[model samples]
Target: MFEKVLIANRGEIALRIHRACREMGIHTVAVHSTADADAMHVRLADESVCIGPPSARDSYLNIPAILSAATITGADAIHPGIGFMAENAQFAEMVEEHGFTFIGPTPEHIRIMGDKVTAKRTVQSLGMPCVPGSDGPLDTVEDALATAKRIGYPVLIKAAAGGGGKGMKVALGPEQLREAYQLARGEARGAFGNDQVYMEKYLAKPRHIEIQVLADTHGNAVHFGERDCSVQRRHQKVVEEGPSPALNAEQRAHIGGIAANVVRELGYRGVGTIEFLFEDGQFYFIEMNTRLQVEHTVTEMITGIDLVREQIRVAAGAPLGYGQDAIRFQGHSIECRINAEHPDTFMPSPGRIDGYHAPGGLGVRVDSALYDGYRIPPHYDSLIAKLVVHGASRNECLMRLRRALEEFVIGGVETSLPLHRRIISEPDFINGSYDIHWLEHLLGLKG
Candidate 1:
């Protein structure tokens, strides 16, 4: 076991990792920007370092500074709690090269899955279904046009190395393909420093489902069911639930097995998420997240597994303590991403939190680092907390979620709490029949 672990991110995720480390008797070192000196994670860590200013490029994303902090703190491992350099192949390689363990997949696996084009091809070769599109990256406008025509109208041009909805566009025909392709490439290059773009047949409405798989150095891998993340906006998930309401027992087992097999076949380690688009009762590969997801709480709630602790154990060369059959999943779980943003316009709202009160009840959990006087820095993402709930059934979970949302309180800055309440009250959402486009359609109707 690592004596000390340095967390390489901020906000709720950093705190989440810190809590996990404490439970395992591992000392934690928190690296933060100047603006986060008072951040909860920094306060709770055994030690801390002010890496740089508020800018992410100078702090959380600053590899040299983070490595230096880890070295000075004598950290045996670094846990990049999602975002920033979590999926960066170069970062992973550098960590290992510098003689420190990275609590994630191998650098090679990260590289393979980092590129959208290669990931799709690799998964397809493994017998995973994929949407029909360009076999590889399309280099020119003509190439994109040809691919779009072959794949039919409404094709999606996406960045090969992009996530969080950046570097993506939709074109219904040749007339719109050129601009869309160019824009996607430019955005991809700016966001990920890789302009390679690929095309895929767009599904008008599909549920975003993902399988969470965990592996260890001893060649054991297991999956903990699936999460339905269909309620989304701008290609970002807003609400997520476990044991997808859309899938039955057979389907869950089938997809979960496939996800686990992919990890075992590649000899991968740590925690990873395999995402898919579900339509017409069929699942198609989307992409793989090479780190712990923000919604991992819901999976843990349903499966009774602490993913962070498992991730740390795997990185330390420990074998999985349990097998597939030993794993048992319980009832339904839901997670609502509490962001500091306007409910209607979804604009970022960062400031000092005047009052804060988290709901408490059976099976309700709120993962946050916010305090009454804590100031939300504008330099980071708007997500401030995660409200997760679990119940015996999906219907009961929804009811608990509704009551919990109503009980949540925040002041000084607007939040998405109201929007979540409205969403939970809607018939389609309550019925668990919403798709990827459902949130956008709901907003459009309100407009």
Candidate 2:
């Protein structure tokens, strides 16, 4: 076991990792920007180090400073909590090269799964179902048009190295292909510094489903299950639930088995998510997230597992000690990502939190670092908290989620609480009839 671990990110995830470390009798070193000197994770960690100013590029993403902090603290391992440097293959290699463990997948796996074009080919070769589209990155507008025609109308152009809906464009017909292709490439170049883009046959209504898998260095891999993240806005997940209402027992087992097998074959280590798009009873491989996901809480709730602790254990050369059959799935779980933003306008709301009250009672959990007087710095992501609830069934889980959302309160700054409340009450969401575009349609953003 590692004596000390350095957390290389901020917000609730950092605190989440800190709690897991404490439970395993490991000390933590919290590295933060100047603006987060008083952050809750920093306050709770065994030690804290200020790496840089308020800017994320100067602090959270500063590899040299983070490595220095870990060295000075004598930490044995580093946990790059979601975002920032979490999926950076270079960062993972550097950490191992500098004689510290990276509590995630191998750098080789990260590199293979980082680019969309390569990921699609790799997964397809692994016998996973994939959406029909261009075999590789399109070289020109003519190539894109040819691929779009072959794939039929309404094709989606995506960046080879893109995420969070950036570097993505849709064209409904041949006439719109050139503009959408150029725009997608431009966005790709601006966001990821890579102009490479690929094409896919766009499905009008598809549910965003992902399988959560964990593997050990000892050739053992198991999948917790699937999460239905269909309720999205601009490709950002809002509400996530386990044992998707759309899938039956057979479908769940089939996909889950495939995911576990893939990771085992690839020699993957640590936690990773294999994302897919489900439409018309078929599942299409989209991409893989190499690090821990923000919605991991819901999976943990459904399956009695401490993913962070497992990640740490695997990094320390511990075997899983069990197989897939030993794993059991329990009740249904739901998670609402409460961002510090307006519910209606969807604008960032970062400021001092005057008063805060988290909901309580059985089957309700709120993961947050907010305090009564904590000032939310405007420099980082606006996600302030995660409200996760579990129950015996999906219906019971929704009811519990509704009550938890109503009981929760964060004063002084607007939040998306109201929006979540509205979503839970909607008939589509109540009956699990929503898709990836459902939220945008509900918000009148889509026609």
Candidate 3:
């Protein structure tokens, strides 16, 4: 067992990992940027090192600094918590080469799944259903037109790297395809430093469902069920839930098997998610996130499993604690991302929090990186906190969530709490028949 593990990220996830390490009796070395000097993770960890300045580029994302911290602290492993160097393949390889456990999948798995094009192809080879699209990178307008004709309209042109809805465009015709292709390519190149763009048949009113899969080096794999991430704005998921209200028992079982099959076939390890777009009763693979997702808490809330701890155990070559048949899922879980942004205008709102009181009592969990007087840093993600609630049933969960949101008293900066309140009250959302455009449609911002 590793005596000490270096954490290569910050904020709520970092603290979450620290708590898990404390339980496992593993010492933690936290790396923080200058701006995060007073961060909770720093104070909680066994040891901490200031990597660099306020900017993430000079600090949290600095490879050498993080590696140096791990070496100096005598950490046997490095755990990248959802950001910074989490999915960087080169960094993963470097850590292993330096005799430190990466605490995730192999570098080959990360590299293959990091690129959208390669990931789609690999999943397709594993016999997973994917949305019809281009075969590979399209260089010319002519190349795009040929692919679009085969794919049919309307199609989505997306960057072959990165998510969060950046470098993506939807086109309905040849002229629009040619025009949008260059723009998407340029955006992809600028955003991810890779101009590789691919195509997919765009689904209208599709539900975003993802299955959580965990695999061990011993070839044991099982799924924890699915999360409904249909509540999104600007292509980024704002809210998520486990045991999707829309899924039937049979459908859930089918999808869960598909996710486990992919992991076993790919020789992947650790916790990963297989995201899919469901339209009309058909499921199409979107992409696989090779790291723990922001919505992982919802799954944990439903399944009673600590995914982060499981990742560490997997890296240690431990066999899965539970077998496929032993894994049971119950109840319904929901998570609302409380970002420091205006509910309507969606602009960043960063400042010191005034009154910071979270809802408690029963079935409510709030994961946040804030406290009284903790400055909401303007340099990073605007997400101030996460509100998760679970219930005996979906309806009961919604009722509890609505009440919990009412009790949360966050002051100083604007938040998405009101937005969450509005969503739970809406008839469409409550019906669980919502699609990707549900949020924008509810807000009257159809783009």
Candidate 4:
């Protein structure tokens, strides 16, 4: 086991890693910007270092500053708690070159899976089904047009290097292809420094299902199961649950096996997520997240497996302690990402937290870094916490989630709590009949 691990991110996830490290008897080093000197993770870590100013470029995203902190603190490993440099292949390589373990997948896997186009090709070659689209990047408008004609109308133009729903556009037909192409290219270039785009058949109202896989250096890989993350806005996940109500036991086993196989084939280490778009009983590979996901908590709740501990153990050259059959998936778990934003407008709400109290009781867990007097800075994501609940069943889980949300309270800043309450009470949501477009449509009705 590593003597010390440096966490290279901020917010609740940083705290999440800290708690995990503490439980494993590993010392933690928290690297923070000036804006987060008093952040919860900073306060909880065994040691702390100020990286840079408030701006991400000079702070959280600054590679040199983070490496310096880890080196000076004698951190043998660095755990990137999602976002920032979590999926950066270059950053992972840099960490390894500096004689520090990057507690995630290998840099080779990250590089291969970081590009959407390359990821699709690799998965397809590995016998996983992929959406019908261009064989590779569409170098010309004619290539896109031809591919669209073959795949049928309503195709999506997605950036080869895109993420977080950026650098993407949907074209209903040839008339809209040109505009979508140009816009996606510009956005992709500006955001990822790569304008290359690819086309694929866009399924209407497909559910976003992702399988969580864990592999160790000893050549053992297994999957915990799938997470239903269809409840999203602007392509960002909000509400996530496990053992998707949409899939049966057979379907779950099939997809989970495929995800596990992919990890094994790649000789991947640590935790990763293989995302797919499911429609009409068919699963099409979308992309792979080469690092731990925000919804990993839901998977942990159902499996009773500490994913973070497993991640650390694997990085320390340990074999997986359990096999696929030994893993048990019990009950249903749900997580609601609570962000400091206007309930209706969804604008960022960054200010002092006057009154704060997280809900408690059975199966309720609040992963947050908020306190009564802490002021939220506008320099980063507005997400303040994650309220995760588990129950014996999906229905029970939803009910518990509702009660937890009602019990939770935060003052001096608007939160999405009211919106969440309204969502959980909706008939469609209650029945688990919602898809990716469900939340947007619900928001439109309110508008």
Give the candidate number with the greatest lDDT.
2
What's each prediction's TM-score? 0.98, 0.99, 0.98, 0.99
lDDT of 1 at 28: 99
What digit string (tens of lDDT, one per residue) describes model 2 on residues 1-447?
Answer: 999999999999999999999999999999999999999999999999999999999999999999999999999999999999999999999999999999999999999999999999998898899999999999999999999888898999999999999999999987799899999999999999999999999999999999999999999999999999999999999999998999988899999999999999999999999999999889999999999999999999988899999999999999999888888889899999999999999899999999899998999999999999999999999999999999999999999999999899899999999999999999999999999999999999999
Query: Per-residue alpha-carbon lDDT of model 4 for 1-447, expressed as tens digits?
Result: 899999999999999999999999999999999999989999999999999999999998899999999989999999998999999998999999999999998999999999998899888988888989999999999899999999899999999999988899999989899899999999999999999999999999799999999999988999999999999999999899998989999999998998898889888999999999999999999999989898999999999999999999999999998899999999999999999999998999999999999999999999999999999999999999999999999999998999999999999999999988998899998899989989999889423
State model 4's lDDT: 0.93
Better of 2 and 4 by TM-score: 2
Give stretches of model 3 more than 4 Å off: none
Q: What total of clashing residue pairs does each candidate reach? A: 0, 0, 0, 0
Return the candidate ranking by TM-score, descending.
2, 4, 3, 1
lDDT of each: 0.94, 0.95, 0.90, 0.93
Best by TM-score: 2
Q: Model 2 misses residue 273 by how many Å?
A: 0.3
> Pairs clashing in candidate 4?
none
Candidate 4 stretches with Cα past 4 Å from truth are: 445-447
